[model samples]
Target: MSLSVMILEKEGGLAQTEFLEPSRKGYCLSCLDAVKTLQETGRFGEAQNELEDALRESENWREMAVACLLLGELFNKWGAASPSYTIAIMEKGAIYANRAVQLWQIARDEKLFEENPEDMDHLSSALYWKALNLASVAGLGGCERWTVLEALQAATEAAEQMSAMEDKKHSASEVKARRDFVEGIIVFCRAKALEGNHVSPTDFSDCYHQDTKDEVNFLRHQCLELFISAQEILSAGKQTMCDQNIKATTMIAVTYRLLGEREKAISWSEKEVQGRLQLHGEWNPRTQLAKRNLSMLKGITDEDEIEEDCCKLFSFESARSIKSEEITWSLDPFKLSSTWRMNCLLKIFLLTGVVKEFQIEEDKLIKFLQKVRKSYHDENPFHNWYHAWSVTHCAFMLMKETAIGKILGMKEKLAVLIACLTHDLSHPGVNSDFLIKSASPIALQFPFSNVLEQMHWDEARSLFEEGRETNFLSHVQEELRAEILEMVHQGILATDMQIHKQIVNSLSNRRDSLADFEEDDMTLLSDKAMTVYDATSPADRLELFKAVVHCADLSGQVMEAPVAYSFGRAVLEEFHQQAQREKMENLQESAFMKNLHE
Candidate 1:
């Protein structure tokens, strides 16, 4: 009897069925039949038990391998239903897959399938399934990093082997199907490598060292190539059983976007969106995700236009002015005459030539300064408007040192100053770390923290949104907007600590080419580079910014001991409130707070 018939018999009646096939005379295909019936009926636990019983009675390597592979697939599906079962399911799957691979090797070595085409196919199928199981386990997070690496290596080898077999003159249709299956496995491994724990090897391994960016870039390219190959193969067939093509295409688009290939990324995304919409008809999860991504891509393409539209969507109201005589600080003693100073500075060294002195718009500058001041937290001490003002002045000072300072001149200085002052305006009173750890909805929406910095540009755009009558950049050409946006995005993303060290290291290594100094004056260039480097490096510049804002946020701390004490108490109270919420939800407290309490 065929396997399908045995499955039907087991489902129809819980009786041991005997097959008349010569090869299966002593084999217990009935055990597989029972497991299949149970699995089809959604009785996973029962199916698992049946498979375990079958394993004990099975002596044939082929039968044992098939049974184990089935068990692994069943466990994988069960684990998807509940995360609590993930570890158990993954462990069992790995164990069975390993066993199947070993059995396949033994069968091949014993020459049991030298002329048996059916048995040879079965052995290869077992090996392919084993690799699939390993890849799936590695894709699930919390597995050891080495396990993922090994799985990826195994999947790649299996895929190459299958592809070679498919190229043979007498290769069967079944061989082609197996080859496609292996390709899918390879793609899964690529995605896992990209999205899984991506920390540097130093964090977990003692023998291996690899540059994180280089590794990510290599793997990302591999995924794209595999995706393209899969697409070509899938297109040749009218229909594919695995649905790997669409999934691989989506991942390729996402990876391209992550790699900053905006144009190609947007193209792939648009294609995926159109294809899915044609297939699914309406707003399913895939369609919605595609739409959202398309919207983001459009925003990136014509940022100024989107910002203008947003401003037209919402209007801002001016605050009511307070009477000078009525203003009092009785409740908060720190609200008195406390001297505020900014602790950080941004020095912009202009390499181009300059011009002449022009009239300074003092009131406009003060407004920009005030905007920066407002970004500071009520308790933060390190950052404030003064620091912004200092940075603006430093940039101007550097500009004055350039030949371009003698040309169109003070207008450029005013522009740079205005940019610096308004850079960090409307601060959210939290660091990037806080945003990431809290899984703030904004972080989820963008998946890139630097995108949040676009908020500043948004605010800047608001001023001219209404018919461009009051728009500051409205007088400027549209061509300049894209260039300015790029500069601003780069500067803001540079502030993030995660990418900071890498950026600095890259700069340091390329100093000779980037410094652009004469041979005799190379020493001067080195010194200048060091200065610029130190000013922007995380250890110095970022720390300075943090300290400045932190001090400004806690400016009240300097007023009186009691006032500082109250501020600290309020912060502690907020932490306690958050901790209570986490406790109620059965979640652990944040690591920082957990450390504090311990």
Candidate 2:
């Protein structure tokens, strides 16, 4: 009986030893360590392989959690290479992250005891990874209210879980650092939710425990604070290393601007500019923004002064007409102003070689001018004619510059001249918005304001077609017709300011590209094209053109201060008359009257 009992005890002891052997546990640990090392070294493929090996060896919830977390991170990194893949990768990442969370819960429930800091760190790391994945998924899912609400809930829960873990007694510093990191992320998620137009905070009422407005404001403040803190930390070391701080400052300024706190926005913007300028120089992008904003702010007050200065710069005077031509239109015996006719003649002479320079054929020029003057006597305004003429004069002066003159072909030069001459030939004496709002017959015929510009081109073409061909087209060829037409069309379209800035920016980039080309290979034609392009560009030329014409259109305004004041007074009276008409008709008050009062 004693021998049988000894045999049973020996066998049971052997079985227990085998089950609890250190070597078997060490092997499992080594597998986990190797997988982590691979992941740390960024050998994602190798890390995946090792993780699979570790999982096969352990088949436990802890190892499974680590593997899923690593897989999610790897995929997330890959997705960042392209925005188009963000949604796909984020979806997959969310799946793995959720899997990691589930596995971690299982491991926690099992209550496996481990003395090493690595075990606790792994759980914290899993939570951090899960939060990041959830946040990414939220970002990629876009602004759908329901979808964002769901994502915000998930991210909030993950953040809370992380915070709770950090509060534990045995939490590692690394774990606490991760908790802090995720706090910023939570703030970012909340800010994104508020800022996005589609995802209203009210959509998540069931999950949202706080007041929507208060929550949004709190999140915005939290985001700003975190950004400021990060910037402070980054810039704490050296004065020379403040790039990150400058960027953060700009972001804060932009946020303030979005929030409608203009004063704070401006203050922060000034700081960014001043800081960068002190660190670098005036040419820096930040400094440029500051200067531009300052200029814009000053412009409101300086516009009248600037307009006066521009008028003095481009002084216009009536030229002596060769013949005292009395032209009659529908509006009585209108003696055509000889000085005005002479000014038009001078413009033609400067712009085209249609007549000899020293031996100017005053007769031909005067005849042409008189005909155009008579044809549009009722339709054209003095300001519109002068504006077109001034722009043409500038274009002519620009053409005389060595760089522009050498490259522009005869055809292109003529197109520019003709474009300048006819640009505002058929102008109506009101702004586009006024015309559109009033449903003026011209505006009704062409629904698009841009088409009004096109009409000018068509009128010019009709004039040429009606056996009124000018000297500029003498060398024109049938083959070059398409190109000329395109140039003219572009030039007319350029007079519209709405799309001017974009076109100018494009041309500027092209000019920069051309600057890199060798001098011998440089084509001034391209440069001339850009010059014409800039001159003809809508907003490009309109703002300047409007000011020029407004002054010239009202040139009678500055004939003397009293004359100018009377003109201004007359304009005010006309506005008051319009307001009275509107009131009687029960129509909305016109913007013209509003401006007059303001």
Candidate 3:
């Protein structure tokens, strides 16, 4: 299935041999190094040489795709460097940008995004640059209509591309913030074009003749609206960059001036000038430019007034805080039977130094758990939030009793814990068999597969992403989290018994391996590592995680008689209902329905 329905959601430098056996990644990195210096200094000519080399003998389509986009961007950057527009450079930039867009389109047509979704981001970047190249044309001449509209369209497509990156590599806010940035830039271009078109004639310019007073009035209003929208997005996107705000202020000043609002123009220009002067200092070139603009607006002959740039970049000391002191975790979910008992389990997980070992923030973990707890279908007799807590509790007890925490490394333990906690999340109070038999749409996506388990994991993943945005696992490194999550995914899926033979065989091998191994004290590994611990292979650890969670999920069968029977009765009741539902709806009854009376 397309992932849309799914809750979708560096190393620098290179050695020589790394290039000899060049992968797409190696080629891309080499190309990146070539252009990396361009951002600082150096001639565009040198950067083009490296880019051409990468493109000349490219074996990887994705690498070629990246090279084309980067080549386009390189030319664009070069074109934008000159104060006066150079027709040759501008035309070359536009041509490359268009080619980049075409190559990306061809890739999509070839199902490259489907074949390897990571290519989507690169394709998106290619689309955005096309818009950027067109937008830089000042929206003038006979091509103005096409240039302006095409730029807007391409930028919107770029934003769509940004939103498509929900593979857990980025937070939702990070994606939205990026989309907002593109929206801001595209809108700013429109506003800039309009403002420029209506400006008073310069010695060699004829733009004023192109616009009548009424046209100018209408265009200025449109410019103001677009500028405001751009400012709001830029302010909210990632607010640390003070430069965005200054850029917006400059636009506001220019637009107001074109509208014949001299006082308002001067007012906004002064803010920009003052901000630039304070931020960059009086001697800075940017500050000098701002001063000249302000001087023209204010009709001043005197020295410029300097103001303090009180604006600051974002810095959070809490991001680096370490919890060295031990915490006493005392919550016993069995004794404390509140439906909200899951909250305590989460807290205990954190306070017991487990989270410290994982480098996950306590508050984010708590909030994430609470979100899952609240999302449960509590109305269900079984397979509800309380049952979720019970399974997790049983898992916790099993881990403690077996000293599994010691035997299975932290990643395995974590995978087992999280898998147990979220295993049955969002259950519909019906078994997967019934859903499939009834021909439900939910089953259609995973026909003959673990539909319910897949759905539960999908829901859990959605909730997990929400928590991630709030920095729940912000303390955890990305690679480590990905590793743990892989195990967790296996553990959750292992709970499904439809493919019992395969799971049993896999677990038995790992179980025997672990059984002969001597158990030791909990030896914590680095929180940042994604590697396997001790002598165990990653396959063994993942298998162990799945085996342990499977045991926890079925632990209710071995509980006290009363507790075990209660669960048995609940399952039977749900089965009986499903049977009756099948009869009423004229559907095939599942195996559980045959034994409902028993």
Q: Tell me the tens digit of each residue's lDDT in model 3 across 1-598.
A: 1111110100011221111123543454456655544333333355456556766777766666666675665555444433223334445555566676677678778776673544555555666566556555434311433454455455556556545645354445444544554555554455455544522323113333444434445545665765555566556665423554666677778777756577888898888888776555676555666776576455323321221121011012221232322111233333554523534465446533567687766545654565566557867766777567768767766565443555577777777777887888778777887776654545533433588877667655544431132235555654576677667777788889775677667644433444333344221222111222332666555655676788778766667766777777777776787777778898777754666676
* RMSD (Cα, Å) of model 3: 23.0
Q: lDDT by residue for model 1 over 1-598, one digit each (tens)?
A: 1122223322232221211222432555646676556534534345546657778877776778766655554444344323323544565666675676677667778875553555544445555655665666655643553366676566567556545542333234434544654565555454454444533344434312265445556655765676666556665564332234454466567667656676777787787787667654355544665676565554333534554443332211110122222222222423422212221111121122111122212222222233345454444332334334434433443334432233222333334544555555554544444444454433322324553454444444333231222233333433344344334334444434565556545534534554465555542123454443354343443332322222222344443466557555555554554555556656555554443334
Q: What are the root-mean-square deviations of the candidates from the true structure over C-alphas?
A: 16.7, 28.6, 23.0
- The most accurate candidate by TM-score is 3
The TM-scores, one per candidate, come to 0.38, 0.33, 0.45
lDDT of each model, Cα atoms only? Answer: 0.46, 0.50, 0.56
Instruction: Count steric clashes of candidate 3.
Output: 1
Compare candidates 1 and 3 on lDDT and give the better one. 3
Give the candidates in order of TM-score, highest first: 3, 1, 2
Model 3 TM-score on a 0 to 1 scale: 0.45
Clashes of each: 33, 10, 1
Which should have the higher TM-score, number 2 or number 3? 3
Off by over 4 Å in 2: 1-60, 78-81, 113-116, 142-146, 166-180, 205-218, 229-598
